[model samples]
Target: MKVGIIGIGHMGQAIIDGLLNTMKSEELILSNHRINDAMTTYQEEHQIEVVTDNQSVINANPDFVIFTTPAPVTLAVMQEFKTLSAQTVILSAAAGISLAEINAILPEQPVALLMPNTPVAVNHGTLGVALNEYITDSEPIESFLQQLGDVFITSEREFGIFGTVTGCGPAFVDVFMAALGDAAVKNGLNRELAYQAAASMVKGSASLMQETNIAPDVLKDQVTTPGGSTIRGVVALEQHAFRAAVIDAVEASNG
Candidate 1:
């Protein structure tokens, strides 16, 4: 299938990386408003065609066109292709844009909103997908998305919250991990080892949660014996309003 990508930014590049393993490079066409060294480097490394303008991408008449540009840019690009054939499926990775908004600009077009995190670069990220009524067969797109990570089909109303948790959660986890490393450093571990230990612990904890299908509180209780150091640390976190802070962070991201 002929696929066109409209930008080469971080998310755009990640999508390209994920697709290359599944789709033929020659069947893909990429175009950017401003082609930078990174885009040029990627083009040369992958030996894929990189056109100079959006019109070239539209002219290609690809079956699938992914708009990886910013929200404002996506709107502008849709306007530029307002007369695009209804047969093409339009997917956007812009966060604030909604399916209704896209349909307003291009009615009857198959529009889907995809929210993916940076970890998609490593093929283990979370993706939130919301398809419009115009999309009759989502299997092809969903199958391709599954190659990058777990894809959750949701309503447009739920897509933003999904992004808040999976997309913004990475930064929150990084901050918590940094604090863990700092505490280990205070306890005499070297900086590198401290970070490694903190990261590994979090990774294992997440895997354990998935494998055991246990609630976080239950897992916490399992790890904390009476008067144990773990319970003491948990008490300190509770005293500091850790849970409330994390909750507020997710809410803030949603806003």
Candidate 2:
């Protein structure tokens, strides 16, 4: 498959890297608003073909065109390519842009709205997708997305909430891990050891949650013995309203 990507920014580059590493595409065409020295270096390092104009990208006639530009710019680009081949599946990774809004720019085109996070660069991304009514389900697209990472199909309304969780969840987890590492360092462990220990513990705990069908509360109970060290840690977290704070953070992101 030939894939064309518009707006070669961080997220755009991430998707390009993921696709180049995982999929067998005949060619990958990329276009950006303004080329910089850094972007030129990236293109040379990655051996990707960089186009100078928006029309050049459309003229490439790729099977799929991914729009990684910001929401406002995406509409303008879509308007410019309003006459793209009907078979082309247009996918947008811009956050806060709805499938309806995308379809409004190209009323007859098949469009899919996708929310993918930075984890995609590591092939562990969690993506949520929603397609416009004009586009029927296609197995190839789902299979292609699965190659990047775990993917879920959601309604437009649920897309924003899921983005708050999986799209923004990694940074949230990183913040807690950093705090845990700091505490471990204060307790005499070296900085590197402290960070590794905290990170590995979190990874193992997440794996346990996935492997075991137990609820998180049940898992917590299993770890927290009566009047034990685990219970003491839990008590401290509760006193600090850790769970409430995390929930509020997610709510703020969704808003």
Against the hidden reference, what TM-scores do the models get?
0.90, 0.93
Computed on alpha carbons, the lDDT of every model, listed in order, comes to 0.86, 0.84
Question: Candidate 2's residue-wise lDDT over 1-255, tens digit each?
Answer: 778889888888888878888765447878888878998899789877677687886787888888999887788877888878888888898887878787887887888888888878877778888878867876767787876778888888788888889878889999999999889888898999988988889878887987897788999999898999999999999999999999999988888
RMSD of 2: 1.7
Local accuracy of candidate 1 as per-residue lDDT tens digits, 149-219:
78989898888899899999999999998998898899899999999988899889988998899998999
lDDT of 2 at 253: 83
Write down the TM-score for model 1: 0.90
Query: Could you tell me how far off, in angstroms, the CA of residue 70 lies in candidate 1 after the best superposition?
Result: 1.2
Candidate 2: where are CA atoms >4 Å away? 24-26
